[model samples]
Target: MSDAEVWTFNVDDYAAKLQCPTLIIHGERSDGFEAAAQHVFRKVPAQNKKLIIVDGVFHTRFYDDPLVIEPTATEVAKWFKDNVK
Candidate 1:
């Protein structure tokens, strides 16, 4: 099998074994990754899990766009405060 296929093999099993809190950040415009994120979210065993999809931008925009980054950072900070503390 290809490396990508090999890398994803048994991914659900790994996700199921996760015990810590997880925050999944996705861009609403990143349609390609949205389903994959949802799949992993469903598979993860952690009760303290969150999925935040920032609106109006694609994947890479999360790195530079203020509109996306601001909300994403807010969510991340909230997650950290709620879970890490």
Candidate 2:
């Protein structure tokens, strides 16, 4: 898929179909995705769902910075630990 295709993909359209446990993690400074992430979170039908916003981190930092990655990884692990069955 191309970047254009990814840009066109409306995750909200598939949010209701997320019947399984879902973990929505984003950076606090992800101005572009934060609202959309929250929207998807609200739309998801999963009984077990969560949204985590890592402090002082931007979208890309969530993938790179060690300070940001550690706690975020912990959160991801905890989410999987609590949700994956």
Candidate number with greatest lDDT: 2
Error of 1 at 26 (Å): 0.5
lDDT of each: 0.84, 0.85
Candidate 1: residue 78 lDDT (0-100): 84
What's the TM-score of every candidate structure?
0.78, 0.88
Q: By TM-score, who's the top model here?
A: 2
Residue-wise C-alpha lDDT for candidate 2, range 1-85, written one tens digit per residue:
8999998988888998999988888887887778877888999998888888776778999777898888888888988888797
Compose the digit string of candidate 1's lDDT tens values, residues 20-74.
9888888878868888878988999888898877666799988888887888888
Q: Please give the range of 10 consecutive residues that has the lowest summed lDDT in model 2.
A: 28-37
lDDT of 2 at 24: 86
The local lDDT score (0 to 100) that residue 47 gets in candidate 2 is 89
Once superposed on the true structure, which residue ranges of model 2 sit more than 4 Å away at CA?
A: none
Candidate 1: residue 4 Cα off by (Å): 7.6
